[model samples]
Target: MKHTMLAVLLAVVMAPGLALAHSEARPGAPADGETLSAPPEVVRLNFGGPMRITVLKLVGPAGEVPLARTDGMQPVTTLEARPEGELGAGAYEIEWRGMGADGHIMEGTVDFQIEP
Candidate 1:
């Protein structure tokens, strides 16, 4: 009987911690609803798991600018790039594909624009 009691107590303590470990992108990226003026220097992907970014693309005037891995970050979940060059003005679409430590590839986008 004592052993069973101890096992029950142990499980009660560990259950909550396990739940917090797996994080989710709530609502959506660019966080469901967010506004911007000019295209963000870098498209940020914030997630609960450590995600591996596989693709990045920015579509705007002139043509589709492939957003380099270096969008707006040096390290630790940052894209190391900036919106530059002769890219024309207009709303831009930022698309990205990546994987999480959970072994799942999650892709999303956020649209921030440049005014006329």
Candidate 2:
């Protein structure tokens, strides 16, 4: 009975960490709902854990913008990208998918606007 109680206590203590194992993006550049005076040259994504970007995209009013690029497997907690072309004042959505060290796929989006 003592052993069982100890096991339950241990499980309860570790549950939160397990639940948070999945990587999640922290506050990123041009944070969601943020309005920028000038377009950001580079967008920075900060994750909770080391991650390898699998898919990244920037969608604007015009259409999909080819802004983000990665050479190869780069396991990093932060990923930075410089857009390919000039961005005009408008709303943009930054979408991303990444793989964490735990081998789980995590994805999310950040939306912001540029006001000139």
Candidate 3:
């Protein structure tokens, strides 16, 4: 019976790739040496599990850039983004915090540059 329980536990632990869960930014964003043609309108993230973004903020050079205010609050899943201004052509970083449906908080950042 112990061997059978061990087999079940091992399978549960090895299923999904946790390392690939929290993504940083949307595609086409500038990397370390990459140049972007246009500015991104909003910061986006792709999460592996269903989640609610408890906190999503775009931090600019100064301090914190305000997200375009929304009419109503809604539960978020999959890719999360703020309703806000066009990410102007410049250096920017996206800061985000999301909670998995299972209640774990997932967070990360992605940096990109926009060519003037």
Candidate 4:
């Protein structure tokens, strides 16, 4: 009973720290729900922790747009991406998959719009 109680206490104490380890994108460029009169030349994803992006894509009104990954893609705090062509006025979504510093695979999406 004593051993079991100790284990439970440890688990409770560690849970919050484990939860904070999950990487999350915060304050992204072309932030969620933002509307712009002109398209942004580049998109920036800022994370709360270090991460390595493996896949990044952009889906626009016309369809999936070609996204080129820029530098700063290592296990840094940010990842940069740019579209191959100019984006017309419309809604767009940026999807990304990556490995967190904790060795966990994580994915996220950001949605925004280009105003007409």
Candidate 5:
């Protein structure tokens, strides 16, 4: 019983730290699994804390698409990018990798569809 009690105490003490360690940035615009009637003007990411985006890619039905970064390659709480050209109707995915405020490498993807 004493061992079990200690284990419980450790879990309670470590829970918040573990949660923060696993925290990740989330898509702010053109949200994950979203379907839109038209293309979004910009792609945005919202981070729980400041993060330096290392790589950002936009993939469409045809192939890889190009983007113009508004946030540059710097640490920011919010990051934005604009597509260089108009997007046609199809599925799209935006993948990103970054160095989180905690100095850990973090990555995520946002999937959305453009309706014809």
Candidate 6:
């Protein structure tokens, strides 16, 4: 009984940390696996807590697409960036890496397609 109680107490203490460690940013505009008739002017991400985005890249058929970040390099709940110019119809992926509120590095990609 004592061992079980200790285990339960340990779990209760570690649950929040575990949750925070797993917390990651969710796709906002131009969601993952989204298909659109036209190119999106801006890219966005919504985070559960504060995150400092280190890298944000837009890759298209031609290769790396340039983007103008609106959020700069800072901790934020929502991050936004605009493509340097109008994107051509093709398959695109937005890759991002950031430091979470818990100080862990998290990275993800959002793939989208623009119909020709």
**Whose lDDT is higher: candidate 1's or candidate 2's?**
2
Off by over 4 Å in 4: none
Off by over 4 Å in 2: 1-14, 68-71
Error of 4 at 27 (Å): 1.8
User: What is the C-alpha local distance difference test score of candidate 4?
Assistant: 0.88
Which lDDT tens digits does candidate 5 get at residues 1-113?
99999999999999999778644776589999999999999999899888899999999988888999977697988998999977999999999998976788998899999
> How do all models score by TM-score?
0.58, 0.82, 0.59, 0.89, 0.81, 0.85
Kindly report which residue pairs in candidate 1 clash with one another: 70-80, 70-81, 71-79, 71-80, 71-81, 72-79, 72-81, 73-79
Report lDDT per candidate: 0.59, 0.88, 0.58, 0.88, 0.89, 0.89
* lDDT (Cα, tens digit) per residue for candidate 2, span 1-116: 99999999999999998878877789999898899999898988898888999898999887888775553658888888889877898999999998988899989899999996
Question: For candidate 6, lDDT tens digit of each residue in 5-116?
Answer: 9999999999987897654777698999999998998899898888999999999988898999877698889998999866888999999999987888989999999999
Residues 6-93, model 3: lDDT tens digits = 9998878866655455433334233333456876654555555565666666665555677753412343544534635555667677
Total clashes for model 2: 0
Error of 4 at 46 (Å): 0.8
**Per-candidate clashes, comma-separated:** 8, 0, 1, 0, 0, 0
Candidate 1 accuracy as lDDT: 0.59
Q: What does candidate 4's lDDT look like per residue over 21-114, in tens digits?
A: 9888788898999999899999989988998998889999899989787655678688877889779999999998899988999888999999
Which model scores highest in TM-score? 4
lDDT by residue for model 1 (9-78), tens: 9999988976655435534334434555444555556666555666777777667876556433222244
